[model samples]
Target chain A: GEEVAQTPKHLVRGEGQKAKLYCAPIKGHSYVFWYQQVLKNEFKFLISFQNENVFDETGMPKERFSAKCLPNSPCSLEIQATKLEDSAVYFCASSPPHFVAKNIQYFGAGTRLSVL
Target chain B: SQQGEEDPQALSIQEGENATMNCSYKTSINNLQWYRQNSGRGLVHLILIRSNEREKHSGRLRVTLDTSKKSSSLLITASRAADTASYFCATDISGNTPLVFGKGTRLSVIA
Candidate 1:
């Protein structure tokens, strides 16, 4: 697909277990974003990366959620000590070097996480 | 939270009719974008209207942004059954800011 590729279409984890999801951005894209969608509701921004550097992580919950987009590696979002509230669809998106006019982002199919 | 709030959380319309969804936000935005999500799929960008622009169109989809009122609207003309999906509006305050999305409107286009 020409779109972002997300791994583990669906994930199941215990309350205290760890869950990690990976995303591969489209070729040549320099920006990556992570969002969490609950049911069919609004999207919550978790973090963003500009190539290998963290762009904005103010939305990240400082305690358990962490994400990285390292060189030669797929972007990954990890949830440590997952809770029931962590259950949701995690979406990954990517965009070319954003210049306002080229700010359109493409999204992945998302990884549905079920924390029991 | 600077998240946008969409009006008429749900809309039901017959095919061939026009459907409109509105979104209001609390902060100044660089641009407002509309996206569509079908069932459990990821959101696909529909249209984007910059803060300095009023309207834009792509096929049967039209998007209007009113920066003064901090609101925007997405209109799907001559809607089809395939247009049934959840529509969301996302806003960004700056080029580098992360987008804050609206709660979305579940639009049902009945055949």
Candidate 2:
């Protein structure tokens, strides 16, 4: 298995529709992070999880975005009422737990979501 | 504001030449990392420099960190066409904090 796996390499949805993205972290890695990149620009941190528990989510856009990671299941980020502005490539990354958290993330091939 | 900002948004060089990229940050950090992303691909981790380490070398890659200056630089020796890609610098500011990435520097190596 790959270090990190993201489902649906490309997703297309109409405005106001829902978009769901899934990620499978590497085995033995407990930390997961999600990022959004638009138009080849900088990566924007969206959320992170530590072993199925939400660790930090300050960057999440609250109105229409949510995410979850359950034990034995792939972590998922769901966006409701997708807007044209929401179009971007979503990336998933994972890292092993360390005492000092000098985390070196392993990223998955992103899922490019296009909102029409 | 972005925590890490990379200078020279893009660079072009001939094969076998050296390529160097610099990054600056605005805050204290636990560590800094460099990653490479090919077109339409996931980022590939290149190197990680801790706050206490000044320099590290792996193969043809050399990385230097200046904690006092809140900056870092990555130098790749003998650049190859295969090395062409976008390079990004990410900062780990604190424990359990998400990495803040810079707008990448696009490197184009001419064969």
Candidate 3:
């Protein structure tokens, strides 16, 4: 695909329920990133992968947030025991190899998560 | 924590006027890129400027970077109502690291 794809345009989950989101990077892109936007404001970087390998996890919350990218499958971000504050838009982005394209990312339409 | 902060949280302009937004970062960056988001949609990449480069232009968009001041500005010339959107500035501290985005500036182009 030419654009990064994200599933579940809107996810409504009860508080404390588990929530999962999926992202498929653009074809031929090696880097995938996840970001969380709250109140349509600042984007908080969550995690990143390079070809199914974890490139950076510094932004992830180790307690209940986990993510994975496996070969032949779309990457996944799962939040366990979701809280009211967890409601926001989750965006997925993909970029070509840094050496080749200088880290310009292409974004998906994003999934709006609502925890009530 | 966010690395960049955009000034003028919101702006209103009549169509056909120019709109300018400013961004200031706290640390050195390898490159700075601007993105626009329309209402509930995802962000669209606008333009990118490298650390060593001072300015760049693409169509109706112009970007300027000053590493010494750790600031950048985006100019939208002859804007239209379709140009109304929230603009963000993201910084790439390292070539391979995730980009750190600013809070964004919301611009409303009234017709």
Candidate 4:
């Protein structure tokens, strides 16, 4: 069994401020992902990384959001300017197989971000 | 685009009753996975069925996949109140694409 650990269970930020979230994947996993859940809606993918390199960032909002996975370190998602719409629970996931979408992913408890 | 759509947005059943949820997808997939979310907690993987497989079972959960119809169903037998949660179906298509999740089915198990 494996786990993805996320820090800062909850966060509160004023509008226009920045918010940063962290995710530590299972030791052997190579693929990491970030998602946003707004209420009961389905999770929306934000970005994915393979080790320290980003694999896909198509779902990211380039003007304000960025994510990186530093060597030997967990991944991080940073939103430079927060907005009312940014209030949601953020999830992190990891998969052991780097290039296979079929690989089952493990998820973290997530960071609940509230933007005022 | 999200590939899966779950039907019967909500369900309420008594204990000992079997609860079933259906899901339909728009595209071909490498595999389909079912997950359960207990309120604000993270999603817990329930079962995964590959495109080549027809039926799979784990504990009290049974999953049936029909590639021809591009649909799947998850059945929970002898459900309990602890099983009350939001269940979602996700699709892993193209081998490398990120999993796209459906809106989910909210099931409430009454004692």
Instruction: Name the candidate that leads on DockQ.
Output: 3
TM-score of each: 0.97, 0.97, 0.98, 0.95
Best of the two (1, 4) by TM-score: 1
Residue pair clashes in candidate 3: none
Residues A2-62, candidate 3, lDDT per residue (tens digit)?
A: 8888988999999999999999999999999999999999799999999999999999987
The native-contact fraction of candidate 1 is: 0.64
Clashes of each: 0, 0, 0, 0
Candidate 3 whole-model C-alpha lDDT, 0 to 1: 0.94
Tens-digit lDDT track of model 2 for A35-104: 9998886899999999989999998998999999999999999999999999999999998887734688
Tens digit per residue, CA lDDT, model 3, B1-111: 999999889999999999999999999999999999999999999999999999999999999999999999999999999999999999998776899999999999999
Q: What TM value does chain B of candidate 4 have?
A: 0.96
Candidate 4 lDDT over B26-93, as tens digits, reads 98888899999998899998999999999999999999999999999999999999999999999886
Q: For residues A1-116, could you state the per-residue lDDT of candidate 4 as single tens digits? A: 26789989999999999999999998878889899998866789999987888888888987899999998777899999899999999999988773543668889999999999
lDDT tens string, model 1, A8-108? 99999999999999999998888999999887696889999999999999889999999999998999999999999999999999988876345788999
Best by TM-score: 3
lDDT of 3 at A93: 95
> How big is the positional error of residue A15 in model 3, measured in Å on the Cα after superposition?
1.1
Off by over 4 Å in 1: none
Model 1 TM: 0.97
- How many residue pairs in model 1 have overlapping backbones? 0
Model 2 Cα interface RMS deviation (Å)? 1.3
Residue-wise C-alpha lDDT for candidate 2, range B1-111, written one tens digit per residue: 468888779999999999999999998889899999999999999998888899999888999999989989999999999999999999986655688999989999999
